[model samples]
Target chain A: MNGDLTVSAASKDTLPTVFGYIGIGVAFGIVGKAAGLSPLLVTLMSIITYAGSAQFVIVSMLVTHSPIFSIIFSVFLVNSRMILMSTTLASYFKRESMVKNILVGTLLTDESFALGMNKLNYSDNHLNFAWFNTANVISYMTWILSSLVGAVLGNFISNPEKFGLDFALVAMFIGLLYLQLISDKSINFNLQLIVVGFVLVAIYFGLIFIPSSLLILLVTLVACSFGVVMKHAFF
Target chain B: MPSFNFVLLTIVGTGVVTWLSRITPFVLLKKFQLSKGVVEFLSFVPIAIMSALWFENLFVQHIGHLPSIDWANLLASLPTVLSAVISKNLLVIVVVGVISLGVTRLMMGM
Candidate 1:
């Protein structure tokens, strides 16, 4: 009975994550259509890029007819943080099969990482790889299918922008940020200061720059370093 | 319009590079154990990157100008932040945020 309860609870926990992905996926698809990408291309992007910020950057760049080099460089800059996410997650996935690890890693977005990390803490199972893959695959499929739907129906939507679909990504990030910031009791002040400082710097540089991607990258790295140093020196 | 070959290559390149970034850390850490200090440092990277991205979007402008604090955006952002804090659900937060933005825009006659 205890084992069955645990199984049920585990399944229940995972269901919300899948449902959350579906909702975000639909929003992403609608945003993709508004951004003027074709349904097939958006579907491909949802499957291939999978990173929401990078996809937004890609679409924005495509709309502007930016050079190929700029597009690639911007994607690289925006995604550099994934290096950190992947590195931290490595400890949890060290023992998985190579093929499984690769497949799972490909789907390790911020949402999946948060969900998988929570499940990891509660369960002592060795099927970490499976759980991670399940979350990723479900999220990936949701994104692709919904993007296709949005693309096809995009024409009839008239002005989806009127719905403020663009802010969907921002809302998702802010929600995640709120959760993380609220949970950390000690360093909330420092985190806010760092965020504000970065925002100011991004604004300053943005005023002078044509493509703000590189400037944002520089300000972020500097702010991160400053925060780390401050945490060590004072806190 | 971008040629089909160009689109294909872009997709392939993005997939290949993204996969490489995801896999490298896992492979390296597994084959050779990472230090505790390194892991601890890495834990903060996501927040750092996320902050940078979020901050940039809120302030950066397309025409090499400062992002004007359009009242509609600010009003919409307020409710969005509130929903995010109270709901703790991604879907609810996004839905409320989008709706708020739309309603605020209409109210502002923008």
Candidate 2:
């Protein structure tokens, strides 16, 4: 770990995330356009919403003419995970000013949050505000711009599937999941990974009955609690 | 065309909900002290959440049924997962996965 990698240099580390965002953003744009949304409208939605999955859900609901209340409810349900993520990230930004933290928190997406946390974990510095903000800002910009491009060219590429853009976000998530694993020599780390995997798979199976958002929230709480209990009892 | 008011409401409503979710914890947790046990356990949240997301996307189709395996995605993910294990680089993983899926789609003539 080079201690000399300044915050600016660390910001460049988000370039890969930038690519992932653009891919997913374009997919969203294409879908939005196909759903009869104007390019300007979708771009505005991206700017304000800034959430990929939620935007996708919103667009699909719009197409179906679902009630606005349900659209709002579904987006909230999908994005409720942000609450957990924000809480985790809050502990890290304890020293920063409230305004800056709020600004940074608005741009939090799953990829950016995971990558930002990973960088912080591996780095020696206490908290590199510039690096974290740069990563978030770049990710947000890339997503908005790419989505606008996709909406504009929505007519050109009738099938985003032929290009396999749908898999980009999933691939990115897989990479992120791989990155989150700590390669330490601790047995507890491995045990935690196994527990998380087991819990997630169980939740997946449980989805047949439990609503996905509620199930995921329940699983997170239970899994985290189990981790606490296990650490206290054994580790 | 959908009514303009409905569209506007959709955007504004979604924005409000999204912002509220993101802001609540930042406001509530800032002045509070969290327990060590809780923080330690929260470390695993990312892995748990990401796994749920990746698997849900790869496997699940809809509500109230078993996730039928999509062979194209499954076959394509094989190389992608292998590359992910080998290289923690996001670019490498995405390129490998996209190309793998593209070739599979081509062969299957879908």
Candidate 3:
């Protein structure tokens, strides 16, 4: 397939994700601001990271005064799934030029990858460079703009707690996790999630004796192994 | 606020690391050809990671002490999970979360 820009239904499909990005991005920005990061830095973080859960976790770590190494390590761990997404997306790129592939890869986010991949399996016409890039660009801009607004708005929020800004991150995570669990319809998949969920909380109980920085990473790996094991056993 | 330099460094550090995770396979891999076992293992990573993140946020992890649940977050999660189930939409779930937490704290007077 030739790689000229095509723009048919892409814009229409991107509208819903734009709304999601704006909402969550604003939540992240306000939380970042309340954690004492500047509006510019919050917006910059959005531009650079383009990840929802990772940025929120980073803000929480920053609030706790986590070391730089720990923070960087968390970013990698939190985003390790991106590697899989990139590899899967690469399969769809076929013979596309390196420039197109690299640029697309750099802009990949959970939403962009899911949306683009959703279309690719349905129709070859749905995933040209133009359609995919339009979706990514739209989401990227909405996220950054919303973050900037949220951070600026955060300055006026003398009491972030009363407004429930502190709980937003927790809520966001739960929302995302629940969404991930339900996205697949298989009962075994749900059971896998439940297995991982139990493993996670059970290991997190060790936080009393172990530092969370270590526990978080360890718990994620162990829980995933458990999930994979259950996948073999049940499915 | 953190020092400008520290903030800048964090931005750059996370950016580079995260960017690498996103771009490396695109540059190197020609296809998604991981072994079945590897793919299955990788598939579980998000479930593991996201659940851990959710649990951590819902509970206050105290060093040298057992974790305590954040009542506000715990309270908000009921409605948030419901919204996720009903709408399967991020925007709806998040909006429900913010409002639920705000209402819970208002009632608790915390």
What RMSD does each model have against the real structure? Answer: 4.4, 2.2, 5.0
lDDT of 1 at A4: 21
lDDT of 1 by residue, A1-235 (tens): 0112143443444454454455456665666677766778878888887776677677777777777777776777666656667876877777777777777777777766655543443454233665567667666776677667777777677455576666665665565566556544435566655655665565556646545545544664565566666667776
For all candidates in order, the CA lDDT equals: 0.63, 0.77, 0.71
Error of 3 at A84 (Å): 5.1
Q: Candidate 2 chain A, which ten residues in sequence have the lowest lDDT sum? A: A1-10
Model 3's number of clashes is: 0
Best by TM-score: 2
Kindly report which residue pairs in candidate 2 clash with one another. Answer: none
Please give, as one word, the docking class of candidate 1.
Answer: medium
Q: Which stretches of candidate 2 lie over 4 Å from their true place?
A: A1-7, A184-187, A213-215
**Residue B94 alpha-carbon offset, candidate 2, angstroms:** 2.0
Off by over 4 Å in 3: A1-24, A27-38, A49-81, A84-97, A110-135, A165-190, A199-203, A206-217, B1-6
Model 3, residue A8: distance off in Å is 7.5
TM-score of each: 0.79, 0.92, 0.73
TM-score of 1: 0.79
* lDDT for B93 (candidate 2): 89
C-alpha RMSD of candidate 1: 4.4
Q: Which rank order by lDDT, best down to worst?
A: 2, 3, 1
DockQ for candidate 1, C-alpha atoms: 0.49
Candidate 1 chain B lowest-lDDT run of ten = B39-48
TM-score comparison, 1 vs 2, better candidate? 2
Question: What is the fnat value (0 to 1) for candidate 3?
Answer: 0.67
lDDT of candidate 2 over A125-195, digit per residue (tens): 34455766777788888898999999988988778888777787778878877766653222377666766
